[model samples]
Target: MQNLDILTEDHYVLSAHIFEPRQNNRRILLINSATGVKQQIYFSFAQFFAEKGFTVITYDYRGIGLSKPNKMRGFPASMRIWGTKDYKALTSYIKTNFPGYHKFCLGHSVGALILGMNKDSEMFDEFIFVGTQNAFVGNLKLRTKIEAYLGFGIVQPLSTKLLGYFPASWFGLGESLPSGSAFDWRTLILNKKSTNKLLEKSDDFSRNLTQKVFVIRAEDDLWLTEKGVLSLLHNTYPDLKPTYRLIKTSESEKNEIGHINFFRSYNKKLWKIIFTRLEEGSHNVED
Candidate 1:
């Protein structure tokens, strides 16, 4: 069954959904998505985790989805705004409300970056990152890099400056991509180094984690490249080096799933490796 609740922090109402199994489990899994994506995006995975005997919690960011939008009139809404504040609030809420369960986190893309940025906490027992990119498209083709810089570096700054904030819908052909959220993609370039620095400040947070981390990647993904992988390795918690791999051809060719499609795709096989990683505890999954 599914339950709904509200968690208010930093003056924003975060809408949370809980998926419970028939019997209560001692473990609870928190699913965090990339910027602008809603908690609803993880309905299937939430249900799957619940069915596997984990109570699952999913919520929207402060300025996105059902939660309250950032009320500031003239400032762009970057992922940095919501990542540090909203995720910390959600983590605190879960640690307080579900103290009995062994908490775990599953972060997708930039969601992993946000988790890496959080202050010290024992709220999460383990962590999994899907499609996490460490650095901004460094391994991508020259044209792709150019487009990112031009789109984010030039256009984003100008748009946010002129409009106070980028609109929620702008970019691509018929794409309803959020303007301020995408602009924050530029922040990724800046924060990539900062994320690494965060680990140094809290030596124990990285060294004393309760469970090891697992990283899953898709080979066809244009986002996280070899350079990003290096960055992730550099910043990861001590004794918790991530195990990772590219998606296999069988799933990719059959489903034509790429990047975001891995989560959004309706193929059960896509999650088989993920489940296997969870079962093995310390195993690294890769293509």
Candidate 2:
């Protein structure tokens, strides 16, 4: 694994790590992280893919994780910037450093959402979305929906207003998020139609994402529902239908494979499923 400091066109510096296999196969995989989640969370997964002979790269968006400013309270960052600038830079890095390789992406949650936000989806050979959803608060279960409203609707706004950032760490919610990203998420959750205007500005870039997409959902994930996942895919890629898989928990599996646990080493079965799908390079649906 090699650490890299990548600079975006906008001069924002992003921290990244690259895992290369002993024998290169001219195939590269990029792992886009979930919101407020560090790139390191995917390190073991990257190593697993690398052992399969595919080069892997993972990085944190600006103002998050290792790329965060020393004082994150007033740092400026937004979902748009994450898609347009941060991801664009990472894509460029891959194209320049690993030319002639078949590029694939594994996007988690907001990671998948940002892919639709960017105009460069054509650059990827395929996309694997894990626990990805539109995040409409109403789509959450009744209990989780109330939690979402309190956390994102009330706590986030109140915290950002008072501290200039959403200190998620204070509430054990992962990492603190920039005010811009927090506010943007709140707006999206509260007003669903806002995404339409955002998409219209993209000039149908999402539609241009013609490559095959594989969506994996965890049955026990409180944050996502099947309806929300389908809605997000339909809105983002109306022309092409993505292959979907819903993972069911088994008694043999000692650990719970929740939204975040899929990437952990304990979930070897799930990892094998993802690896097999990537190797097939086509939609192979399994219940």
Candidate 3:
């Protein structure tokens, strides 16, 4: 695994841990978690991708993980303090520095949202949304949903306001949801109006963005559902070909896995299937 060199370390202080294979030809950037989850969460995935001849780079989002935090602001402030700008800077760094590489991106949850927010087409050759769902509806159980909203939408914000940072136990959301992200997420659920406005500003980014989108969903995901995923795909540009598949249930469990544990499937069949698909050299978007 090759180490990442920090390029443009300024207010955003962009940084990444790069894993370049012995025979590097393709570049795949892992957009890290925004919920203060460690970049190490994706270390195994990085190693796996690097071994496949893809240059993999994973880094912490601003105010999360190894990257420095901006404590100058409080809760929601800290959450919105970076995100879009950091990704923009990171994309620029990769394009300018890493030439002669087929670029791809795999973003998780909010990481995927941020990619949509940036709407930069020239940044990569293809984009993969892993663990991404239509919207945040907690889980199958109503109680889980309530708990999430209370913990994330309500209690978490209150905690951030009082404590100056998001409480860690708040189910990975932390205190990042302010009016902006929260509102954006809400609009995503309610309709595509929010995404439309954001896209309108990007100056026909859809034309540049080949419809080839790969969305990976968990069979037992508590948040995003098949219905939501379909709705989201419907709102996306028609030219982009978006593919959705369930993370097959394990033979032993006879049930599916949760939103997170992408690696620890009932067995390895789920991931193996995904990796195999990635290995096939074609974008489903055109069809």
Residue 258 alpha-carbon offset, candidate 3, angstroms: 1.7
Q: So what's the TM-score on candidate 2?
A: 0.93
Question: Model 3 over residues 177-266: C-alpha lDDT tens digits?
Answer: 333344444444444353454444443344445646688887666776675566455654445568776665553154656665674433
Quick one: best lDDT, which candidate?
2
Give lDDT tens digits, candidate 1, residues 1-287.
55555544555566788888877656777888765676777888778877777788888765566664545344334465455566777787777778766767888876776664465334565688787766555645567677766766777678756666554357641112345555556556545453454334333244445456777777766655766765665555445556776685466536455556676647556776776766555222211
lDDT of 1 at 156: 64
Per-candidate Cα lDDT values, in order, are 0.63, 0.81, 0.57
Give stretches of model 1 more than 4 Å off: 1-3, 68-78, 172-183, 190-211, 236-239, 282-287
Off by over 4 Å in 2: 194-204, 282-287
Clashing pairs in 3: 211-240, 211-241
Task: Provide the RMSD of all predictions against the true structure, rounded to 1 decimal.
Answer: 4.5, 3.0, 4.3
- Clashing residue pairs for model 1: 245-286, 246-287
Query: Candidate 1 or 2, higher lDDT?
Result: 2
Instruction: Report the candidate with higher TM-score, 1 versus 3.
Output: 1
Per-structure clash totals for the candidates = 2, 0, 2
Per-model TM-score, in order, reads 0.81, 0.93, 0.77
* Residues 183-261 of candidate 2: C-alpha lDDT, one tens digit per residue: 8777656656434444554444677777778899987787889978887878766655589998886721754767887
Pairs that collide, model 2: none
